[model samples]
Target chain A: MSEIKKDLLYTESHEWLEQQDDGHWRVGITDHAQAQLGELVFVELPGEGDELSQGDACGVVESVKAASDIYAPVGGEVTAINSDLEDSPDLVNTDCYGDGWLFAINVSDESELDELMDADAYTEFVDE
Target chain B: MSEARKTPLYDAHLAAGGQMTEFAGWLLPTRYTELMTEHHAVRRHAGMFDVSHMCIVDITGAEAAAFLRRLLANNIDKLEAPGKALYSCMLNEQGGILDDLIVYWLEADYYRLVVNAATAAKDLHWLQQQSQHFAAGKLQISQRSELALIALQGPEAEAQLLHQLPSLGAQIKALKPFSVLRDDHYCIARTGYTGEDGFEIMLDAAAATTFWQSLLDAGVTPCGLGARDTLRLEAGMSLYGQDMDESVTPLQCGLGWTVAWEPSERAFNGRAALQKQRDDGVAEKVVGLVLDQRNVLRSGYQVFSADDELLGVLTSGTFSPTICKPIGRARVNRNIGNEVMVEIRGKKIPARVVKPVFVRRGQIMPGIET
Candidate 1:
């Protein structure tokens, strides 16, 4: 089945967010989204400290077939970037939910999580 | 015009959970899963493509060979063997390409021609007209639209397809490249479009659905036209409309080598024009370009010199599955320099001009130095 981790939050654009120990939130593409995109060739993620609003274009993902924009799930400042993806983008294809996580962000507003989808809601949204 | 054409294996594609889309006027499978996934599957293992939309035509008569010698751009005298197939272009007298087709020598006076689907009607009309001028009753071109074709391609295609038809196992093994064999029930050709070694099978349209499902049951991954396009593009194979249109001559589209100008006596349509171009030094050559950067270069993109001079236009391009880089074929001025930059979204990306065929047998070619 599609990966819908209960502890995480989701975006309609198919990105997932998990709260880290720090004040930042870990962000990555859900398993369903990665599977739909296929093999990842190149990734263009924002650098650390890049400020972004909710729904802002934070990065880009280019697959062998097409390129897609990675939108910020919630407003935040990119606290950390996944440099591993620069050399091994296929990690996104292999483990989209775990080690393939995109980046971490220090949220500009924690209440924006309310606008994001929870596991159950995201499941229903994707299914529909 | 909105009414979509359906192939015999349409239901099979649906049953396999294929994403359906309209391609070349037919409602066909674009992908069973992700396009890249299916494309990679074909490169690593075996993938089955539903190519029944391709029209197969048969020519037979006392002077069939003679008629084809004049009807096609390539000489047919070389295909003396029964199982041999020859790739040739059907061109108008004005040197415009009508269609590039594969002709199989089935008998002394019989030949099988496979033409692209989009140009099937126009090809048929052209062939009919040519038949009348080149000793009418002595040649006959019959459009066999009732047959269905399935292209099983990739490394393991032969073994997988053999399990489906045990009787043709030995025949498949001995089949050479660009050759075909006709058994009691089917015509199996060792030809494919994916740059992999495989066979294209033709059978009764009614039997197509069952045969397609049987292949799937044999663990043959079902692919669609989307994968087919990327696969062919990577293989450096030309698409009829994109790479070489009616306005192009074989010499300019990297197909001049396929033109047989031997014997100095074989008279074919467009030969004079082609000879003139060849003698006058062809103005352009189709070259392969590998983008040095991450951005994908697409067709209609402007290819320019580093000095900002326009060199050519990209014809077909895609992110190569094997190479993991952007590659495209462009027709550029022969006088232009080797290294050129592609204008992608207003920025110039450096590209290297190298040999046309980029990937072969699941391996990306090396030494494409700028």
Candidate 2:
């Protein structure tokens, strides 16, 4: 079965959000998404301070077969991007939920987080 | 568009963690592990791919040679002896490519052709229509739907093959490149899409599972189409739809050598148009491009001259596992110099233009180093 963390919030597009101690929300692709995308060769992420709208196309994840767009699940201002993935894209394959985190954002509206799926809802959604 | 077809090895693939994908109307494995693992396996050791989705065709009769001579751009007479293979482009009347295929002369009156899976139906219809001009009893065209093919490739391919079929050791060892070894069980051809020493084993579809298992038992890593594509792209082999299609001629796509112009007396399909193109000079030709950056160069990317003038469109592109760099083939202006730019996602990245061949037999070519 695909892993779905109980604490982290999920998006239908397969991105996960974890609240940082500093109130910034951390984002990364779920294990299910990484499995579907195969081993990633490259990941283009948003720069720090770039503003994004809900469901806006942000980055691209490219495997050998094809490229897929990464989306911003909720509108926010980009705080920090994962620079490690630039050199080690396969980190997403090995540890998609941990070190493979994409970017952290300072949300314009914290209410947007409630609209996202919880762990049980995302698990059911993925299973379906 | 309809329900995807499955190869005989479908269950075997699924059991091996093969990631399935729909390709050419068949649901085949794209990669069993990851693209890198399978791609490097073929470069360093032995790997096998279930290529049963490709079409296997047999042509026989008294006029088989005559029919093929007129049908293909390459001369069928060049086979010289039985079990010899010839790579030819079946061309339309306008000198456009119908499909690029490999034909093996099985005997005096029979030949075997392996064509691209995507063009199998169209090719069959064209073959059927063209064969009407030949005498009914003199030519017989049949699609060998009951056969299955597997490509065993890499440096250790022969060693692993000998481990399984030790009885045919001498025959397999003596088989030259582009030759076939035939017996009661299989038609083993020393031909492969990857630029590696390998065999394309054709056996009964019913026997596919057993053979696939035995090869696995011999330690041949089961590969999928993802590695197959990257390997062929690094080798600079032209893919049918990506590199050449019905809209392009052989001369325009680095297939001019496949067109047999010698002994000009025999007129093949698209002879007049090809000859006219040769005489009139081809405007664009396929060339190799190597990107120094880490980004991928994909198909449909625009090619530009140093001054940003549009030259042509890229046909095939990929990150080469063997060389660890981005390489691709493009149809650019014939008069182009050594330097060109490829526009990837609106950014023009400078690339070095060179000859198409990148890797062969696991050895990187002289110019492609780095």
Candidate 3:
């Protein structure tokens, strides 16, 4: 069983949303997604200032077994990407919800967050 | 889903926390711990693998040697000693590879063959059909499904084996590559696919679990199919179904050296077609590709020439743990140059073409290093 953070918002695609102090949203893959992907060998991050749709493919996470696309949970403009992942991709495996956050974004529409699942709903969604 | 067959070491793999997956109709471990950790254990220390799913067949009678000579691409006459082993490919009538196997001359009238799990039945059928054409004497084929095979591979493989079975250490240590020693209950061979010093031991199925436990207690890491694939790929060893199959010939699959054309009079199965193929020319060849970027290369990726003409496709690809880079084998046009482009996810990435051997005996081979 994987840990589901109670305060975070999640997408059906497994990305998590964290509200940062700057009013922007911090995003990363959930614990369940990283566990299923195994050891991460390479991570392709979206560029800062890039605009993304709610369901757009934002980046890629590749393991020894296969590669998976990371989809945007909400429409936003990328504010900052996790540049540390370029040198060390396994951080996504070690701390998926913390330092492994993929990219931060400035939300274009606050209503998109209301469409996301809360922790309790996400836990049930992933379990199903 | 239909129930998959379990190996004798299935319980042992479960106890070791192996992630079980379906492979060749059998449930087997893909990895016990992490892929790279298990892979490095085989390169630096020692690792054990449960390869019992491989089919073992024993051929006997006065015509055994002659029967093999007619059926296989490699000459079995090379095995002069009792326990000598030879790696050969059983080809179809059209010179396409049926399966690659190791044949051991156990005695004057008996030889043993170990083949891939998925191709065992087909290979056996081909062997039986080909044996009907032999003129020397009667041939007997026995499938030994009662035996379990395990491989202990690495630089310290001998040491670990000696530590476990000390009484047989001296004799096993003296066994050269491609040689075997059989006792009442064990058949230990000095051969492996990981390009390392190792022994592939065959024992009774009933004793497999206990033997695996003992090896585990002796500190030999338990490896799975995941690490095994990476290690063999790094060593340039070809996989049965992926690298070559019924539609692919040895000439195109980088296995031409396994073919024996000697005694020009000897007519092996598919020899005529192979001879004709040799007389004309082979169209494609398998070569190693080292990706310049950090991108992961995978099978079915298209290879292109510098000017954007399609060349061939990758047969086996992986992130090589030992080299810490992405490497793959591709069957491409014979005229392909040193540099080629591999199309991955609609992006054409440049890769360097080189010999298939990236690493051998724990040492990195030349031209593969970044």
Q: Each model: TM-score of chain B?
A: 0.97, 0.99, 0.98
Over B5-28, each residue of candidate 2 has an lDDT whose tens digit, in order, gives 999999999998898999999999
- lDDT, candidate 3, B1-370, per-residue tens: 5688999999999999999999998999998888888999999999999999999999999888888889899998777789899999998889999999999999898999999999987888887788777653568998999999999999999998888777887888789999999889899999998998999999999999988999999899999998999999999999999999989879989999999899788788899889889889999999999986676778899999989999999999998888878899999999989999999878789999989999999999987996
Per-residue lDDT over B1-370 for candidate 1, one digit per residue giving the tens place of the 0 to 100 score = 7788998888888988987888778888877877777888889999999898998999999988888889888887887689999888888776788889999999889999999988998888888887877677778888887899999999998898778888888988888999999987799999989898888999998999989888888888889777898899888899999999899998889998788889779888988888888888988998999976665667899899889989889999877766767889999999766688899756688888888888778877675533
Model 3, residue A91: C-alpha shift (Å): 1.0
Local error of candidate 2 at residue B262 (angstroms): 0.8
Candidate 3: regions farther than 4 A off: B135-137
Residue B269: error of model 1 in Å?
3.3
What iRMS does model 1 reach?
Answer: 2.5
Superposed Cα deviation of residue B65, candidate 3 (Å): 0.8
Give per-model CA RMSD.
3.5, 1.5, 1.6
Give per-residue CA lDDT, model 3, range A1-128, as digits (tens): 89889899999989999999999999999999988878888898889999999899989998887699989888989999999998788899899999898999999999989999999999999989
Of candidate 3 chain B, the 10-residue stretch with the lowest lDDT total is B129-138
Candidate fnat values, all = 0.30, 0.39, 0.35
